[model samples]
Target: MNTITANQLKTRGVSIIQDNLLKDQELVITVRGKEKFVVMDMKHYNYLRECELDAALHQAKADYQSENYITETVDAHIKRIKQ
Candidate 1:
């Protein structure tokens, strides 16, 4: 992984983005010694979003075909996710 400390980002932000672009890599931006952000090309981000949507659609189709589902009230579903 390519990591850039917060200090480096303050001074070399543009260069870092340019350097990573040649390799189509993800950049990890750290703040206070912890990874706090990621920088990736917009195309990569869009591809990831498409992949997520595809996976969700596939799961829904499988669930329907198998009749695999559960019924719950909206409030109960919300509580389940909050947990």
Candidate 2:
């Protein structure tokens, strides 16, 4: 992990962001010798978000498949409900 002081990061924010953005690196920003923040490339951030969404979708699908209330077809299920 790469670490940078809060002052250095604040003064050279653009360069730090540029370095990480271009190289897909993670920057750990520290304040008062303690880690405070992290910076990551947009691509990595987007991919992480997508992975989270996929995991959530997968879990939702698993839940739906295991639940007896879910049906294969909405129309057929509605007709059964009406009958």
Best by lDDT: 1
Candidate 1 residue lDDT tens string, 1-83: 68878898789868877786667568888999999998988888999999999999999999989999878999999999899
Any idea what lDDT model 2 has? 0.81
lDDT of each: 0.87, 0.81
What is the Å distance of residue 50 in model 2 from its true position?
A: 0.4
What's the lDDT for residue 60 in model 1? 100
Count the clashes in each prediction. Answer: 0, 0
- Candidate 2, residue 77: how far the Cα is off, in Å: 21
Residue ranges of candidate 1 with Cα displaced over 4 Å: 70-83
- What TM-score would each prediction reach against the true structure? 0.75, 0.67
The number of the candidate with the highest TM-score is 1
